[model samples]
Target: MIRIIAVLMLLIPGLISAYGIKLMRDTLFNDFHPIFFHIGIQFFAGFLFFLGGVAFIGGFIVYRDKKKKKQREDN
Candidate 1:
């Protein structure tokens, strides 16, 4: 479901970001390619976090409003 997907978006990106950081920290860099790749991954992780937060908040708002609306209708 959408909720599951949103949660996964947060988790997967977080894991990838952590792994990327660890890789960059534990390895010696002599070339530009690894640095560039890390930057790209970090950017992607940032984007995923932003999108996931939006989706999670939006979904919560929609669900709350819908529930309230249904209660009003029942009254």
Candidate 2:
């Protein structure tokens, strides 16, 4: 259950990107700079990636601590 949730969490950004790309393709733009849009999207994606990395690291640390505590209790 946790593993499945973790996998879904990792895929979230890709799903968001796909949706954003579809929207961009369907919209008609006359004056907007494409580079600016690309940069903005990249920034948002980078932020999400950073957050996901933090969550992954935090989860690993918590899991490690729990396993260590269990081992100590067993001994």
Candidate 3:
């Protein structure tokens, strides 16, 4: 159950990151999602989403790696 939850958490952020990329790409083509009123805002929001998601996933990996390394050293 714990593993399933973890996978879900990771999957959500991965999807967000992909959507962010799509948003940015669409902005470049002068296409905008209705929620965004301005082109610049859309692009900026996309940038933030992409970076935030990636940072989260990256941090998770780093934390897990450190935990594993500590366990190895302890044994």
The model with the greatest lDDT is: 3
- Worst 10-residue lDDT window, candidate 1: 24-33
Q: Put down candidate 1 lDDT per residue, 1-75, tens digits, no spaces.
A: 988976785566556555555444443443234444565554555455556655666666577678787534444
Q: After superposition, how far is residue 54 of candidate 2 from its true place, in Å?
A: 0.9
In order of appearance, the predictions have TM-scores of 0.44, 0.42, 0.86
Q: What would you estimate as the lDDT of candidate 3?
A: 0.88
Give me candidate 3's TM-score against the actual structure: 0.86
Comparing 2 and 3 by lDDT, which wins?
Answer: 3
Residue-by-residue lDDT tens digits, candidate 3, 1-75: 999988988898998998889889999999978999899999999998899899989888878888787534444
Off by over 4 Å in 3: 70-75
Note the residue pairs that clash in candidate 2.
none
Candidate numbers, best lDDT first, in rank order: 3, 1, 2
| RMSD to truth, every model | 7.9, 8.6, 3.5
> Quick one: best TM-score, which candidate?
3
